[model samples]
Target: MKKLLIGTAALAMVAGAAFAESHSVVRLGTEGAYPPYNFINDAGEVDGFERVLGDELCARAEMTCEWVTNDWDSIIPNLVSGNYDAIIAAMSITPEREEVVAFTQNYTPPSPSAFVAMGDVDLSGSVIAAQTGTIQAAHVTGMDGATLLEYPTPDETVAAMRAGEADAVLSDKDYLLPVVEGSSGEIMFIGDDVPLGGGIGMAFRKSDPEMRAKFDAAIQSMKDDGTLNEMIAEYLGEDSPAF
Candidate 1:
């Protein structure tokens, strides 16, 4: 969900208008809806692990990281199209996607994406909603007899599932845990089989290897210095995920 208090229309208004203007200033894109990773804050600013991590790397790279919040589905295409300098969203490293834009080293190791069918509901022939352009969608595509409904954000996907527009929804387990822990959908994982080992990474145009390398080194250092964990705890809460 590239969702913020500012809806998709407002997000697209700024996202579509953004461009990398100065080499010294790197323009980064994020979904701003993936909590613990990126999301809107109470003060109306983008804040979360991914957002803070981007800020950290920008500080390390000695370059200005100007953030442009956008829909997750458009992040890669727009990067390839040269609309931004980098993408700091929680994007996965999938072979299908690598054919388009390039990615930094995995920031967050691959966590299994899961399908939550209502209760002990059977997902054998159900319609599943997933964030479009995600590995979860690709996995849903492979499930036999299941129809895939792609939404731009997980929030929309969940909303659709709640409205009876979709039978189940697919997303990373960590993100879903926080949102669905007490939701009244009888929601539960369909199964843990067919896990896709795809890790989330920062992304950029394939043409920007040098910049990617710079950010990669910066990110790793953050992980080494305990900065990453601190930020993760800050956004996802103290009882945050270990994955």
Candidate 2:
């Protein structure tokens, strides 16, 4: 979902606040609702894998950073419009996105997308829920005999499936694993995994190559020292592909 927490008003407070004007603080933008990737903790603070990874990267880069949350759909445009600095959400590096913003080297490898449904659902002609503006939604649009139901958030896609509005929900396998395990046998994988995107990478405005380069070097440093792989396993799962 590249999705989040923090209200629109909070987002507006940072809109058009250029990070380029100050090297002291780098604002890291994320959809703070996606757990194991990024989410809001009980204390109402940003938490999860991206949070840990982003903080470490900032430390390595010797940059002071603050987290900002924004909705998934307008994330790119907001970055361009200077809502925040880097997008450290689970945004996959893709050609389409590259047209709008530059990317740091990937932090996570390509992971499979999967379908989850309530029992024995056949996907051939089923209605599938996917977050709007995601690769899963785009995939469903071209899938033979499948109907796409777009939701604004990842949680809503699952809600749609649970409410019988959609037969299945499609999203990153890592993201869906916890939901399935917690469903008390109500949900299960319904089909083969679908692999998409290059990998998850931090996004920056194209005009900020220097910023991109800074994070890229930090990511590469992590990869070299195996810290990135350690983080991938701890949060995404031991089976998650490593750097």
Candidate 3:
């Protein structure tokens, strides 16, 4: 009985001591324009839900994270070319993307990606706006019923739609969640397919199994500890985007 108790105590110690491996510096690339998910501040600091989550993941993994802000269009390519180690921006995992890079298992799942169209406006037969080079943009443009007007970013697309220069905008659900709730105006989810695959992930060049493992452990730790959802709530508001 004493031997068993000692063994149990040893196992408990091992479990308690279990922790994610740390990297010296995990370079995190963010769009720094997608509000609530990731964005830049007046101070030029990258700050948002993704930013908060990155910090937490670093803490959990015991790594130092270097924040890199750049345009959304270039983020994934930069990752593949080793310009940055990982991406924490509001990027979803899709089959096409999987061809170029690997993603950490999804940490936060979001509502389906779709367009928020005005109720009274006839949105059909009109050009839909979305950020250029985004998965949202591709989805909208490729849809059988859609005619797409591409913009540079989510903010620009929203502006064009609000100005009636475009019919509606396609985006991730959480990114538009704030605008929809804040406005008293009516908005509707237009299509059957939201978006396929799963939630946003930390992307890395394929074959970097070591780096992937580090991030996987880090993200899983955050999810298990509730750090991930807490950051999302703080930035994107209380409606959680758990894809």
Candidates by TM-score, descending order: 2, 1, 3
- Candidate 3, lDDT over the whole model: 0.68
lDDT of 2: 0.84
Clashing pairs in 3: 109-241, 109-242, 109-243, 110-242, 110-243
lDDT, each prediction? 0.71, 0.84, 0.68
- Over 4 Å off, model 3: 1-23, 122-124, 182-195
- lDDT (tens digit, per residue) of candidate 3 on 1-243: 000001122122211111224447878888888877777788879887777788978777667889988776666656655667787877777666666667888767745666777754444566788887766666666666768887777888888888888888877777787778776766566655364446677777665667778779988877777766776677766766542
In angstroms, the error of model 1 at 71 is: 1.8
**Per-residue lDDT over 113-230 for candidate 2, one digit per residue giving the tens place of the 0 to 100 score:** 9999998877889999998888888888889899999888889999998999999999999999999999999999987989888889998877777777888999999999999999
Residue-level lDDT for 189 in candidate 2: 93
TM-score of 3: 0.81
Q: Which stretches of candidate 1 lie over 4 Å from their true place?
A: 1-22, 184-186, 233-243
Q: What TM value does model 1 have? A: 0.82
Pairs with backbone N, CA or C atoms under 3 Å apart (clashes), candidate 2: 3-31, 4-31, 4-32, 4-33
